[model samples]
Target chain A: MKKYIWDGIFKNNPVLVLMIGLCPTVAVSTTVQNALGMGVAVLFVLTMSNLTISLLRPMVPESIRIPIFIIVISTFVTITDYVMHAYAPAIHKNLGIFVPLIVVNCIILGRAEAFASKHTPLPAILDGIGSGIGFTLAILGMAIIRELLGSGKLAGHIVLGTKFAATPILFFSLPPGAFLAIAVLIALTRLRK
Target chain B: MIRMIRSLVLVCVVAAGLLSWVYLFTKDRIEEDTRQKVRANLVELLGDTTLTFKPVIPDTLWEFYRDTTKLGIIFRSYGKGYGGPIPVLVALSMDTTILAIRPATPAEGLKETPGLGTKVTEPDFTNQFKNKKPSQIKLKKDGGEIDAITGATISSRGVVEAVQVGIAKYLKYLR
Candidate 1:
């Protein structure tokens, strides 16, 4: 149990170690608020999809398993999208097309194919949770640096005051800045290893 | 082969059932929320006066009155932006001048590129339309009064075009 948790969250972190879902991690990590929003949505979709796929693993035939898993994952993604659109419309709008794009987030599908299809339901659920958290934490690190430098705000509140906020390093909020931030973080993590 | 088909069908049916239940649960709330959002946006733009909304075209033009006095008309305009459709909400005074022009939902509608075209949502861009007549709404490069966003001439033009056409329609409809 602990092994699965440790495996997904740290040792085999999806964003950092496995490097599967970098698209959204970079695209939406401009702000702490947005990163958190994406993280929560991914968490819900991942856990639900993983659980459903694991339970259906036996009945799902090998030849048609990939398509079947996709169907199951998309079902959960649509549910998450609608629920968020209905209730948390602000986050939905901010996240934009990425909500539906969760169907292809890769982390969710990767886990479904690699872990969920072969693992028990409980282990699959844990993997989903751990990987989701790992992804969230990884993006949060990038968001903190980006938001702090890019906008001088922490979750929309002014943190750096007039001095830094006046002439914010706008580069940090753009795509290139996302890459720079992630590269530096990845380098730091490598130093520890 | 038959077993494969059966398994696929069973999985699909179960997934469909679960999703349908969610759709049923959220349908009304989503509808209510959308209407409420549009209403809130209207109230925010028009202010807390005794404004009544009468749909001229239901989602296109709405006739709003403040305490039996005709205030103005609120209508939606679509601009073909770089990203896609940029929907702007235009409020015109009874005299045909723009009272306010805001992004329709404030968040959605404009999927303009981040930093460049997306600057269309910034007050520096949208604020240029406030109180301006349609004739004065075009970009400076096009011999109009407005200034285009740096490096985003197309997106700037899109907003102006949407507002210009929208006001023309409003005038024609009024006539």
Candidate 2:
């Protein structure tokens, strides 16, 4: 029971362990604020979609379950998209295309199939939260490293003063830098375990 | 199967209802947000929030005014940038000298390569356009005054062309 929560968070971590949803992880993690925004958005979608799928598991047929799951997940993703666009336009702009692409984010749909459909509603929601946290933690780590080393800023605030801020590594802020940072974090995670 | 169809229908109906509720709830707020944003951008560019905006082409050209006195008209033009269409806002002086150029939209979605072409939205790049005549809006490489961003000459040229062409077309309407 407890393993459901722990596994997704640490042992079977989506980004670091399973390597799912790497697109947004690499793309949006350029800043800590972006990472947190993406994380919260994913968390909401995952939890709601998982809950819906779990509640509908019985009525849904086996052969057509995947499409049904996608509908439920996309419904939640669209809700998140509209809500963010209305309220948090800054984050909405930064996230850009990735916000709509959350429909295809495997973590949301993967949990729906693997856990939500098979489990009861309460446990399914828990699994969703667990996986969401795991994904958030992973991306936050990536963002912290990328923002600090790449741009010398933390959550859009200047941290490195001016001397070091002028010529930040610059490499860490680019796509290659996302790869390098994630790799180092993954390795460190492995070492800690 | 009938069961599958029934289940899909039921789920879709529920999803539609929920989505409609959310959309209806946010429609006015979203519209207000857009209005506020455009108003704020106008204030930032013109340095005056009290000016009245009389739209000549709704979202494209507007005659700004302070009480009954005319200040200047603001023009918005879209440039075919390296990533996509970059929306450049140009506030022209009485003679159409470029008063200021702002990206007018967040450039993140444009997918321009980061650290280079995307810098077009940065004030450091856009500030170069301030007070330049339409003839001088070209890149230094093209014998004009503007300095092209390193490794992003295409984007730099895009902005120049957008402003030059946009200004040329709108200049006739200013009178």
Candidate 3:
């Protein structure tokens, strides 16, 4: 059980190692709050989808499993989107289309096909949580770096102090900055091995 | 094949049923949230909570009143932004000078590049429009009084032009 969770956070780290679902990771990592919001949303969807798919494995025909997985995933995504919009309007607005775009996130679909379809509900859920954590940690790390350097702030507060001389690197706040940060992260993870 | 189709249909039926349930649960709250957001933005733009707004063009334009006295008018405008059209709400006093301005919330389709183009929605940018005549709406580069946001020239220009065009089209309704 521990191994299942460990593999996702370290061994099969979704963003750094597996390199899936990079779209939202890069797009929403511009702010720490956005990164956290996306992370929680992905975690909920991933866990629920994995559990549902695993339970339905016995009944779902192999020929149409892909469509079934999609239906399940999109249903969860829409629910998350609605709930976020209703309750957390600020985060929902910041997340924008990315919330609905969660339906296309390959991590959820990839897990459904490669792991959940074969595993039992318990293992499937563990795997979901593991991968979700891996994704959250990777994106959160990137957000901290980008937000701090790009805006000279942490989670929207100016932490660097007024005496700091150098101007915030605007490049770190742009798309190119996301690529550079992710590349450095990938390189660092590789170096650890 | 029949079995495959049967299972697919069954899965879809179940999924649809579940989605409808969730939608029904969230529908009223979502609409209420939207109405509240609009009200908040209206209050912020008009600078008064006590004012009541009535639609002159039904969502396109509205007139704000304070106890039967017409205070000003607010209208919606769109600009061709970096990602797509940016909708702005501009409030004008009875004499037609700008009262205040606001961009659409992200939920209302204000899709601009984050950190750069998105700055147009911030007060530092929107506030520049306040108390200015329509002739002063253009950016400094275009020989107008308003200063454009750094590194966000396109988006800044988009809002400036949107307000310019919106006022041109809607000014007659106020008169």
Residue-wise C-alpha lDDT for candidate 2, range A24-113, written one tens digit per residue = 999999999999999999999998899989998889999999999999998999999889989998898789889999999988888888
Residue range with the least summed lDDT across 10 consecutive positions in model 3 chain A: A161-170
| Chain B alone vs. reference chain B, TM-score for every model | 0.80, 0.81, 0.80
Residue A7, model 1: lDDT of 83
Docking class of 1: medium
- Cα lDDT of candidate 1 equals 0.86
Q: Candidate 1: list runs displaced more than 4 Å.
A: A160-162, B44-50, B79-86, B95-97, B103-107, B111-160, B168-175
Listed models, DockQ each = 0.70, 0.71, 0.67
Clashing residue pairs, backbone N/CA/C < 3 A, model 1: none
Docking class of 2: medium
Clashing pairs in 3: none
In model 2, the runs with Cα more than 4 Å from the true position are: A156-167, B80-84, B93-97, B103-157, B167-175
For B95-121, candidate 3 gives per-residue lDDT tens digits of: 989999998866577898888999998
- What value of lDDT does candidate 2 attain over all alpha carbons? 0.87
lDDT of 1 by residue, B1-175 (tens): 9989999999899889999999999999888878887788888776665688878887889888877877789899888888787888888888788888776433565777778888877888778888887788889989998999999888888888888878877775542
Residues A35-151, model 1: lDDT tens digits:
998999888989888998999987888999988988998998899888998888788778988889999989999999999999999999999999989888999999999999998
Which prediction has more favorable TM-score, 2 or 3? 2
